[model samples]
Target: MRFSNYFIPTIKEVPNDAIVKSHILMIRAGMIRQLTAGVYSYLPLGFRVFNKIINIVREEMNSIGGVEFQLPGLSPNELWMESGRYEIYGDDIFKLKNREMVLAPTHEEIFTTIAKANLNSYKSLPQIWYQIHTKFRNEARPRAGVLRTREFTMKDAYSFDKDWEGLDVSYEKHAHAYRNIFFRCGLKFFSVKAHSGAMGGKDSEEFMVEAEAGEDSVLLTEDRTYASNIEVAVSYREPVGRKNSNLSFEKFSTPNIKSIDELADFLKITDKSRLAKSRVFVNVKTNEDGTKTNEYILALVCGDDEVNESKLTVLFGLGLRPAHNEELPEITGADAGSIGPIGIKNPNVKIIADQTLKEADELVSGANENDFHIRNIDLTRDVNNIEYYDIRTAKDGETIPGTDKKLREAKAIEIGHIFKLGLHFSQKLGAYFLDKDGKENPIVMGSYGIGVQRLAASYIEQNNDENGIIWEGEISPFHIHLICVNPKIESTKIFSDKLYDELGKKGYEILYDDREDIRPGFKFKDADLIGLPVQVIVGEKNLNEGKIEFKLRRTGERFLIPENELIVLLNNYKYLFGFK
Candidate 1:
């Protein structure tokens, strides 16, 4: 790829809207151009890198018997309806109208729909299908360049099996494949326990790159062993060390005490051990015809803690929202401000508590009436129908759950996710196969994904320095950058042309900077900004001495080598940099 004919538009100045290092460097290096908010067009330089990443993913996926196919970007709305996700996915999924056609944010429904039509017996028990295709999502606030694009490329793979054991095998195969893909791409990533989110799965894991510019929050243990997405990570704390004070429970009139903050201030208690907070929610249950079936929920947490909705949903197996005024009295038998677990016996409604509240003996709580409060309440004695678990949001400096390590925080970008979907998709989509006993059983499924473009951006985000991107050698846009410091000089031109021809014959994908009018500083600056792994500098002084300058992009190490030894030196450095 000769610079004179290539679209390598390197810029010296960073764009104003580019906030992160990758975003700035990408624009300056002419890798990509934003077409709209959360949408981008990859230019020649960018496409080269993008193709390399996709190829790596394809090779890894293929090695594990993943059959590739192209699913349609536009899908029938009826397919989603059959899976019951048409209504649940909401606006995050891009809906279109070729009268009734919809754009797919993911291909789970269509993939299952195809599998059900083709796979009918237990003999074809396990299959892994994948595609490297474009996915569309109507992101409301897409920012950070390609990191959060509305239209992006994804490598999504789906696994199908007739039984639980086969599904486990398929899941493990993909999990191992995903780790290899990221490792080969030279990404520093960790696989953390993740929420299934709207995908509706029993278990999930995300491959995340640790960076300050990342949007996701991951909790890290003191020993760097246990890590998880905040939604799923458990927190461990010593139970409150207080004996049952034997203080009698009493109710007192407390006007205008609606909030926990206000109640605690009015009670004149500095310690949160004595306070309990009640939160009410209305769980909307959808009927078969997509109608509403509203159920009420009353959640309790320690006064000092906040409810983690992700944890709450996992505990109850239902989505949640704040309670409505009309249903509050019917459910909790009290108004919003004065609802508690004490003496309220509603078997229809479920109650849950933070585990920390169990050990605290004498506590204050709502009195089940407006403008009234109860004090010296023993939860075990006063509340009959209650369940206990760790459902509270972890605060800073708190000990992480299931480990002796204290929690440390770092921002991270989610590059890939592997989910053990179980029967969520199979059951909903009715993708079943006939077993040996002639009974129909829903297929157990798993999903694995890699954000094709986001990984490129994340790589730049973590690896770039002051000059520009230091792309990992295995995935860099070009393996060798052949720069001509004085293309107009006969000696420099001869040396560069000979090397370019020789390297091309040797199968090196070289980016030859052959522009005659460009200055040495401009070429050097552009080389740094473009960030190829190996730079072969052909200059007048070096050529006059029958030598050339070789530099490594990542280390900024340069050395003079004889022209005769350039090929051997380049090959040795390529091997050292983990490139063939």
Candidate 2:
């Protein structure tokens, strides 16, 4: 590709709205242009890198016995309704006006529809189907360039199996393929156990790339043994030594105790663990008649811990929002900062307490009245309708549930996720396979996905410096960037063309900068900005000396070498030099 003919509009200055390193570099490199919020247009330079990543994902999927298909992104509402996800997805899904259809954010529903029509026997027990397609979602807040786009390319794969054991094998196969795919794409990443949100399943894992600009929180141990997304991560807290006072709940006047620290100071308790917080949440559902009804829940947790709504959603349902301030007064008979599960006015409200409060006693809680609190409250005697579960977010210093070590926190981007969606879609979609005994059973399913554009962006997040992106082999737009220093010089132009042809004959993809209008320094800046793996420069001085300049983008290591020696180096380390 000749730079004069190619549209590599490199920007020297960074955009103001861009916050992350990847976002800033992508625009500066002229790889992508924002068409609108949550949407982007990949330029020629960017499209090559995007396609390279896609090819790696495809190869890895094919290695794991995956059969590719082109599934339609525009899916009927009946398909999502049959799988019971139409209402669950809510406003995040892109729905057509009065068309009873949606632009698919994932292909599970339509893929299940395909499976139900074919592959109906145990003989087709384990099959893997996949597609590299565009997906759409109405992201409420789209930022970080390609990181959180509403429309992006996704490599989504689904596995079908006859039994739970077969599903395990299929899940492991995908795990292996994902590791290879990420490694080949020149990303440094790790896998963590994750919560199955929206895509409900028994076991879920996410491939994470640690970045300061990442949105997801990962709770892990120092040794990396217990790694998980914080949403479903479990923690251990040392038991607070206190016996039940066995006293009846006594109401006390505590003025302006809005926070747990204030409550602790008023009660003369050193630790805030003895204080409990009462929070009310409501999940609204669309009834059969098209009316919405609220399901009220009282969530109880230690003052030190916050609620992990992702975990809470498993026990309850989705679409949980904070109850309105007026509604809270009617349900709990108290305003905000003064409510508890004991003696609640609403009988239909469900109460869920964190497991840390299971053996709690002599605790201080709200009195369910204005400016009043209750003392000497025992969990067993004070709250009869409470169910204890781990609905609290994992604290940083808290020990692992089964170990004595504390948990460590990391901010990371989710690059890929694989879920063991056993019978979740198949049973709902009526995709049953006949066994040898002639009995029908739902096919166990697993869903795996990786965002192609996000992967390209994440690569820059981890592999870039102040200069620009330090693109690596197997995913850089081109294998070599050939720059002609003062291409207006006949000798420089002749030498640059000779080297470009030489590399091309060697099967290397080269981006040759043969423009006489651009200065040598400007061409070099664009070369570094684009971050092709290797760069070759043919200048008049180097041509006079019978040597050309070679530079490695990753290390910024430059060397002067003759044409014969450069060819020798290319042949000796072709793959290491990012040759195709």
Candidate 3:
């Protein structure tokens, strides 16, 4: 690709709205342009890199017998309804104007429906179908460039099997394929146990890349053998010895003390372990017949800890949202700041407590009045009809379960996710097949996805400097950045043109800077911003000396090689600098 003919609109200044480095650099590099909030149009330069990532993904998926299909981006709303995900996805899913169509955020329901129409026997039991297509989501607040986009390309694959054992084998193939895809893309990533989220499944794992701008929080052991998303992470906590405080439950007048921090300060209490924090949630439960009922749940946890909503969801088997401040007065007859287990007069409301408070006694709690708190409240005796579970969010210093090593928290971007979906979609969509025993069963399925553009942004997040993005070897837009300094000069132009032609004939993708108008300094800056793995520069001075400058973008190592040794050195470096 010649720079003079290419459409790389490199900007001299970064966009003001761009907060993260990847977002700033991507726009400045002329790779992507935001059309609207959370939406972007990829320029030629960016699309090339994006295409390379897609190709890498395709190669890996194909290796695992994944048959690619070009599914429609716009899917019928009825398909989503059949899988019972239409309402579950809620505001995140993009719907068409007719209300009968939806942009595909995922293809599980569609693929399952396809399988139901086609496969009828166990002979076709194990089938892996995949597609590289655009997915749409109406992100409430999309930021971080392509990392969280409203519309982006996704490589989604689905596996169909006759039984759980077959599903396990299919899942392993995809898991191995995902590892290869990320590895070949030159990303530093780790897989961790993860919740399926809205994508209902029995088990799932996320491929995460550590980055400062990441949104997901991952907990890992020191050696990294055990890791999980914070929503379902488990940690060891030293048992708190039950203090022998024989104080009875008593409510007292405490003016303007609602929060635990305020109560602790007002009562001059130093130990926070003796305090219980109450939280209210509005849970939506779906019955077996597809009816949803709204209920109020009062959750209690240690004052120092916050509730892990995902754990609560798993416990109640329902979708939950934080109760609105306006709804609190009607549900619990108290404001959010002062609601407590003892103050709740409603006996029908479900109350769930954290396991940390099982034997806890003499704890401070809300008095249910406008401005009062109850001290010396025994959790076991006073809090009635309370179910205890492990719903506390994991923290940094907590020890790993059954291990002395402490858990470490990291901010990471989720690049890929693989889920053992079980019968979540297959059963709902009636995708069943007969086994060898001639018994009809729901085809066990698994869903695997890789965010193609997110992977590119994550690559930039992990490998970049002040200059711009440092494109990885395996998935770089181009392998070599060929620069011709003072291209107006016949000697410089001749040397660069000859080398670029020869390199291309040698099967190297080169971004040749043959533009005569741009200054050498400007070209060098563009080279650094684009960040090809290797740069070969031809200047008039070097040409006269029978030498050309070769620079490695990653190491900033410059080498002056004899003109005759150009092809030999480049051929050797190409192999030596290949991605692991």
Q: Which pairs clash inside model 3?
A: none
lDDT string for model 2 (87-189, tens) is: 7788889999989899998998888888998979999869999999899999999989999999999999999999989999999999999999998887888
User: What local distance difference test score does each model get?
Assistant: 0.83, 0.87, 0.86
Better of 2 and 3 by lDDT: 2
Q: If scored against the real structure, what TM-score would every candidate get?
A: 0.92, 0.94, 0.96
Between candidates 1 and 2, name the one with more favorable lDDT.
Answer: 2
lDDT per residue for candidate 1 within 1-580, as digits (tens), equals: 8999999787887788889878888899999988888989999998888888899999999999999999999988888888777877778788885558788999988899888887888898689999999999988889898899899999999999887788788888988899988888889888888888865676688999998779988887756687788887777766654576788889998898987888888988776655788887777877899798776666778788787878878766665777777767777677877877675535566777888877566778887777888987777777666788878777657786564568877789999998877887778877889999999988888888999889999899888889988865678877788999988898888878988999989878789999988888989999988888889999988788888899988899999989899888877877534565
Mind giving the per-residue lDDT tens digits that candidate 3 earns over 346-378? Answer: 667788878878867788777666676778877
Return the TM-score for candidate 2, rounded to 2 decimals. Answer: 0.94
Give the candidate order by descending lDDT: 2, 3, 1
Error in Å for residue 90 of model 1: 1.2
Best by TM-score: 3
Better candidate number, 2 or 3, judged by TM-score: 3
Model 3 stretches with alpha carbons more than 4 Å out: 287-295, 575-580
